[model samples]
Target: MSEETVRSAKGRMGSFSFEGESAEGLLRIGEVTKSTGLTARTLRYWEEIGLISPIDHIENRERRYSGKVLERIDVIRRLQEVLGLSLAEVKAVLEQEDRLLEVVSRYRKDLDSGTRLVMLTEAKRANDEIVKRLDDRLSEIGRFRMERVERGQRIDSAIEQILREAND
Candidate 1:
């Protein structure tokens, strides 16, 4: 893959390149790597984590990505590199985006006419959903931490009893 610099307003350097014939829309992992500068492993890992999914697979089970998935990969890159999100955070964002898509589908008619009420309602719902997800994640992590602390305490108790018995 070859890249040429893209000049922007802030004079920051960005690169763009074309994958031969493959940028025609649907792309394999290698083509995506060539065009987006993401590795095949990263793509597979994203898929494994449910962040992005390929559109189809070929005979030998090679992944094929759609245009939408490519856009998702772009968003994932921005979330990780620019926003400094961990994989868990990025997963939450992706899940929220998925919910937004569902909300958009449900309110397709309102969105078509650019209705403000429907838009605000859907946005609020999306925000609430994200909050709920984050709260649940925090609770889950807390529970795991508590379990580990309890185990450590049990170990310390056993060690203390052993030392006391030996002394007695």
Candidate 2:
């Protein structure tokens, strides 16, 4: 082949790429297979299993994948290869992960607000009890003082009567 014809054939076969024509992250099924090192059949099987979903569709009915799909693929790959988890177990784990995070967030909020309320209530109750006890003790002391004063008056009146009789 001539030099120019060979170069044109290579360019047609995607050997040479311009800036705008290169689809790196925005990949269709073939590119996704190449980038992920996964077979097209495996990708379709994973989709069938509900492990990952395509991000969008092209005008020609091609599925377009995004970075999110790539991340999910990585997770699925790890779960299968490294963790030795079955597809069902991986799906269940992912679902449980979301639920656990939600529950933890709610518990944290409840702990913060409920703990503050409980502490405030306990402190107020303690203060109220202390004030009530002090009031009762003060009232008892007042009654005891009044009774002693009345008894002293009676003794002084008796002494006065005795002195008047002596003088008469």
Which one is best on lDDT? 1
TM-score of each: 0.54, 0.43
Every candidate's lDDT: 0.68, 0.63
Write model 1 residue lDDT over 56-148, tens digit each, in one string.
Answer: 654686676655676787788877785566898888878787878777666765545557567768877887877776576678778988999
Candidate 1, clashing residue pairs? none
Candidate 1 deviant stretches above 4 angstroms = 1-24, 109-122, 128-168
lDDT of 1: 0.68
Segments of candidate 2 deviating more than 4 angstroms: 1-24, 58-60, 98-168
